[model samples]
Target chain A: MTSPWAVIIVVIYFCILGLVVGKWGKGKEKGLNEFAVAGRSGPWWLIMFTVLATWIIGSTYTATMGYAVMSGAIGIYMAMYSVMGLIIFYYIGPRIWVWGKVHNLYNLPDYIGRRYGDRRLAILVAIAGFIIGAPWQIMALKTFGYTTTALTYGALPEVAGMAIFAIAITAYCVYGGMRSVVVTDFFQGIICVVVVIGGIIACIYAKFGGIGPMFQQVLAQRPEMLVIEDTKYWTSIIVASFLGAYCWLEIFNRIFLAKSVRDLKIIARGAPILVGTVYFLVGILGIGGSILASVNVDLAAAESGLLTIFSEVGGPVLLAFAAIIIIAAEMSSIDSQIATAGVVLARNAVNEFKRTKLTEDRVVKLSRWIIGIWMVMVYFLSIGELPALIVIAIVTYEFLATMFPTIIIGALWKRGTAKACWASMAVGWIVCGILQISPVTQAWFGGWGAGITGAFFAIIVYFAVSLASPKDEKVEALFAEVEAYKEAR
Target chain B: MGNKLSRKSKTRLGFAIYFVVVIVPILALPTLNRLNTAEPFVGPFPRIIFLMLLDYLLVCAGLFALYEIESRRGDLL
Candidate 1:
């Protein structure tokens, strides 16, 4: 059943990507800045693509696509939440970038550490972020397996496929670090935009005669696909993603990677249009996908929409391309995660733990080793079956949502104290952690997510303690520094 | 019109506009978040899909407007 041509095609694609990425990512290993954040000089267009590529992980295609197939247009709520997140980041992110640029920060927790002038709070945030973030890496690898196995027509076992990517991604990230990830992201993002999204639109046009006719069938035959079954679930998930905009460590680094605040603003204004349009087109593909499949299958139901569309369209070349783009999307995300974890471990955990007097190069070297080990460990863990991939994704989102209240208020409000930061973050993280693992998903509380409900406590405590708590004397200087940076620019 | 407004009032207005943009779909749930009742074909889509499309376009446009205001005021960073 394995297609010799499919393996040959994917291998050829990888070879080309490897060569291009190697060239761009070369000479970037000389400094930690190049490795961690691409020396903080990414243009607006590259930042826009890389940010979208990194955010739209494999589960986005698989799980979110599956939701769209089942729930109809309501499934586009994933894209909506992301749009909300980007918009929120539009306002909040540039200010954080100002602080980051001044302090030469790489990670989200690093900003928190510097903002509160508390190294320990940074450590607390980093450790929690790492714990919650690790599951996503695992989940993506499982998707890597599913996509590879399905695409290759069983040419290779899923474990072999996962191993191939785990090794390949680890090699490049270790070699070129962030530069390689960003370079490869441009490739992946392009294919995603050109091939994957383009292919979907082409399917509706060529197969169904046009978009209108395709939806006419959906309207006429699969009308239930358009109905909103759980409106509350829809509202809650979008709100959670909106609030947890920057909880993602990769997105946090993307903000720092922008060339300047203006470039970031351009990105904030422009990226939503591009990415939102991509999702809108892809969302339209879902209705068509449902028309192609039996409507009432489970969430992880039937073969992927792309697979069915391409296979039915009788294009092996197109099917292979879609599979590769999906795989490339997975690699883009996992590479960012591995790259971030390595840097955070080196800067926040290793150096801060002992207050090590190590040189910056030494720290960078340490991170390289950590990146290798982290990937190896995740690779080994990824070889197992994980039917709960979507569950892990949801729980991870809830955990990261806990970081929102502290991150926003800490960056915005002058009265925010290091004391209040710890209390509120601790309370939010603990309560959200409990609620995420519990049976219900805050079903009774206006249909919001467990994470947002838990964050309700975080919000109250943040405001209450912020009002009563004594301010850190350094906070005024920090605010002054921000103002001076503003005036200077 | 822009020069007379204080930054605090501008921020409050920004938040008010943002919440409305974000929640407009929720308001639509009672009416538009249903099957293709009012019209079966809103061009290429069912009525609901068109509304969802309008909702996110609103989101993108609304947020960009806020960003422009902040950019003009030198408050983006």
Candidate 2:
């Protein structure tokens, strides 16, 4: 499994990435605005590509194959979440982008804090965002580390592999800020599309003797996978994923970076087709993995299904290329999460405590330092034995989904006071935590999913509390401002 | 190019498409369970597979058409 050529290819890949960092990293460290939002000048195509690339991460590639192997065609539903999420975004994202542009918002917390005129609620958002977002990044990095180590036959220790990934991602992201992340993401996105399509074609031809025979093998053996089940578990996951789209900080943050609301609209329009097609192709490969497993191809692990197929069908060179694609997906996602965490730390958390206003350069520097520190923490966490990638990803989505009510409802409702928003968020997390850990609830409604349960409770609490509580004049004014903006447009 | 709908109307249209193309098919999963039989639609492809593929194509086409119609208004973009 180990190949010196793989090592060589990886080293050269890192060098090319370093060159990209060097090119885009210049003069981007001067201000918090530049560091966090790319000066709000990203074109439509870059916005679309970066968003697409960030969505297609380790979970999409690794965990998805794992799901397919375990449950058959039901696995594609996991990938379909992103497609549904984008469609949901198409409705709400443009308005959020307009609000971000008008208010000069840097992150989600900034939006919530300003909308409610409550700094404490903003800080709460920042802390919650950091907690929910960081674990997923750790999961992505761990996936990259484990996959790379496995591919190289353990020539590099798992911890060391994770450390290398963390260091490289942190270096570029910290140095170049949002600009480098987006730029590198565009490149990564293109590579992901090409590799996924190429890998699918290769697997279909080499492994299954083309699409006809491929479907035939799957149909003849694992026919149950093709059947769509209507269990509460499946419905809950689909619903939560659609609602949870609003909760992903990285995806939400892209709204602030678009050159115009029109850019976001364009992205919303095009991303579903593009991302859907890519995942469909990847799903085909996952089906091929199932066929290989049935014939006793000795898959190393469930999550390694896609990689194993690539290695077997395409040989060492394609294996090496597939390894790079995994790296690309991991870096494209984890870097964005790290960068957003840095922004929250610098802008929302630290600035609240300092007496004097920090210089723009100082703020940017603090952000970079925060990114470095966060990545180190994630690297250490990645080294440990972690849960299944699908579990980790879904759990992260659940916790973040708790914030969905406060965000989406707050944007539309004038009665949504800061106190209610805070209380709703707290209640949501408590319910989610209880449902996730309690054996009784797990037995009763495990299929219903803790995330959807939390979201459902949070939405009710948000509406009930907001209605019962006194309305704030500030919120009313904010609503007026939103209306005025719409009228002007 | 000639279509001219208000933003409100366009929003309604978008939601309608979302319901018809995405939500309805998902809600129909229970009824569609009958199609899950192993009978091959084409060269050993299960009938359910073709149904899902058609669902996917419908979604893509629906969303694209929504975008095209909205873009023609020239006000929202």
Candidate 3:
């Protein structure tokens, strides 16, 4: 059985998360700026941790390891997707950072609004954000709930565990807003880093009987896990990485929170190294766990694979820390998703309700309500037991991959017409959506190819249409003007 | 416009492509296999520990290359 202290620690951790968020970005509740971007005053390290933690949420941790277990060596391709994504973002990010800092851009839709000089595109993007984000929130909660259950060894009902986590996250978010999420992220990030290091140590120690033997064993068992698959998969991993980089709102927002232009570069350069270390550690852990599972353990627990490995290998006490780590990881993601959804709904959907204006306070309140609704929906959806959580988790890469060209081109290419932006995003979103759902595509293309195809279409359509399409002079001027902001600085 | 890649930049670009295309593909391929090879004749080293230690070194080298490219492109600006 799992330890009781693990559950208590998680509960206490969240409460602390709530208190921290409420304290940092409170006292200025009137303007939307504070609620949305924390008055654009975040230090680089805090934002860095948030970006790192956000990407490695419960789904990421669980799914990546599960993938390694099931897919063996080929699974490491997913991390490559992320690496490519970050590299591409390096080019596009600074430009966005320049405009966002100058203009106080808050969310993805806000960028759309500014780029097109139209609230309609903003609203459209917001609606899409909610649709894209809602499913993710549920997935993260399922992870939080499952880890809690397993850590406690099923002392509490699964539903009860899910409900408790959902409520705690919701309460923290509602009370603290983005500030709370950031505060908790720092805590979660620290706990996660420590646990991951411990997990890596444990995995290494257990697998080879020591550091020396671990590699010998993994090499003896599955040496291929040590390398990449081939061109088709490697190329796919690269493309997906670039695409995955753009699809994340947390990354976008982190760039927005840069205290100076220099901070943006610092984050881009430094944050990746830190996150890469974290990813490599988890990836190594996955490799080790898979080697163990090959001997006897089952790989069917798709979401709880990491926890299962730790429990079996390290005993209950270390399992307690690991579970706590996973819970914190889940909360980091859940908080970000809820915040993103709330911002989207209030600014997009609720604003469209006609004649009702959304004040900052009202938007925050509505976001809290939306968070509750999202939690409930996700809890139910998670019960259905999706076919492959890793595939689903990485499925977002297809959506992101397709959207990346449009988002980057729209921001930097002064000649990029709004017509082309819409076409590209729409085509990318649609193609990726179809590929994700179609069984034929799933069977033939596998998880990796779907993203490449969608991205290819998006780029081709975006450019072809962009050249043929008429230019918006105002947008061209804005892009030029934003460039000057950097020059002047 | 004048801030584009120079001759040195082109050489660096070629090296990068060679590394990514030929070398990276060669390294990435064996990951698909189920059986772990204890063969000592592969690319740089045979042991996972040696590869890992080399990977860390390569990662460091890659970071340095990236820094140089970005610095030249004036990412700091």
Candidate 4:
């Protein structure tokens, strides 16, 4: 399932093209607003595309397909949570936008800092966010490296794949910041969906004839996978993923990029279609790959199993597009992470800690430098790759999942105090981390205990601590102001 | 009959629809879809995949209606 050098060249060409598109999208704004959130006047289309591009990460191309091949319909949890999450956001997003708009909040920790008037909590969460994103960047780099090597049939070294995309993404992220990320996402998102989905169709047609026949073949050979085997794990994954959907710094930042609450509503209405299509294609590849495993077991389980299937059937031409599309998706993801990490570190955490706050220009300069530091961190850490990258991704999601109670409650409940948030996150992080051990997760929870159960504990601790603590009048007034802002809008 | 519903009622209805959409895929669908594990094929997809697709479509239509309903001024309050 090796592709020719032509695929490698095409991938490189497209990466350069994406940089040009990103620079074009970067516009001429110099302030923090323009640099961080594309001036917060992003049209519905820009926000929609950027969200989709970031949402469908490299794993959806790689590991999720392997999961689908291993277990039937399990990856639907991936799709299910995404759509269900919108149900929460459709209601919650506007209020977040209102809060962000009203207080000039830059990111989620900034919102927390203002909401509770607690700088330490904000700094802790900000630092935690930057830390949580570490494994994520490594995972993305590994997936990038794996897919390029697999697609090129070992012509392209794994390190080269990681280095190529990481450098290009970091360059644009440093140069243009959020504006470049969103603009390039708009460019890459289109190529990703069209090429990846089209490649999926080509693979199905080349192999199992189509999705139904592929499923029929699998059902005839191994029907166990076709049915939901473990209901508890399945439901738990869906719930955890749904709760965790908006917990990412990039996701929270994307809400602020929307032009209006009306645009947020539009995003809510439209995202299920885009995200659903992406996941739906992943489902087809997974089901089809499940059958392919009977023919080629080892390749079927490879991290690039999905793209390998495309390369095997759809051939080098489709593999080139596949390589390009994945790079597009990966850059869309990594660039956002780098941009947000840099901004949060500089503006949210560093400036707050300073005696005299850094000027806006100095903050932007510091942010760019932080982006470089983050890329270096990825380079050093990813040198020793994790055995199971998706596992790291799940752990990354778990850390963010612990923040669910703080975010959802902070937005809605007036009584939610800073003390409650600290206690809630502490309990949630420890529970989730303990449950994450491989043997315990497998024996006790069947697979997905870390996130959903951890969130359950965090929610309880948040409520108990909130009820026990004296209600802060300042907090009550903050909620009143949030409500007033919503009304005035 | 639908036109007679007030804005308050419409928002409530929207929330109810959203609640159902969330509950189905998250809580109900996996268990319910497993009731028939014979793996029937439905329109180019297996039964489980078909159910997921159906659930996804329901969210699309349901959310769009909610958007239309909530886009109105009084519907949110």
> RMSD of candidate 3 to the true fold?
4.4
Question: lDDT by residue for model 3 over A1-489, one digit each (tens)?
Answer: 345666676567666765666676353554566666766677777777777766677755777677766555445554444444455455566667667776767777778778777777677767755665656776776766677667667777677778887777777766666777777788778778877877767766675566545545766787765554354565566656655566566556666665765555555556556565666666656666666644226555644666666666776656676777777777888787777677667766786565968776777677778767776677788766776764665676567677766567677576776677688878877777887778477455555577777787888888898889787788767767655885786
Tens digit per residue, CA lDDT, model 2, A1-489:
356876777778778878876876544336777888998888888878888876787667777766666666666675566767776667666666766777778888888888888888888888877877777887788777787787678877878888878888888887789998998888778877888887778777887788778877777787766665444555677777777776766777887888876787788878877787777767666766676654224334656776677777777777777888888888888888889889888888998779996777887889989898888877777777766754665677787777887887677667887777878888988988998777378556544677888888888898898889987887677666655776776
What does DockQ give for each predicted structure?
0.50, 0.38, 0.21, 0.44
lDDT of 2: 0.75
lDDT of 4 by residue, A43-145 (tens): 8888898888667987777667767777767756678778878766776777778778877887888888888888999888888878777787887887778
Candidate number with greatest DockQ? 1
How many collisions between residues are there in candidate 3? 11
Provide the lowest-lDDT 10-residue window in model 3 chain A: A294-303
What TM-score do all the candidates reach, one by one? 0.92, 0.90, 0.84, 0.91
Off by over 4 Å in 4: A1-5, A8-19, A293-296, A299-302, A388-392, A437-448, A486-489, B1-18, B25-30, B33-36, B74-77
> lDDT at A44 for candidate 2?
88
Q: If both were scored by TM-score, which would come out higher, candidate 1 or candidate 4?
A: 1
Off-target runs (Cα >4 Å) in candidate 3 are A1-5, A8-19, A22-30, A222-231, A293-296, A301-305, A312-314, A352-357, A380-397, A429-448, B1-77
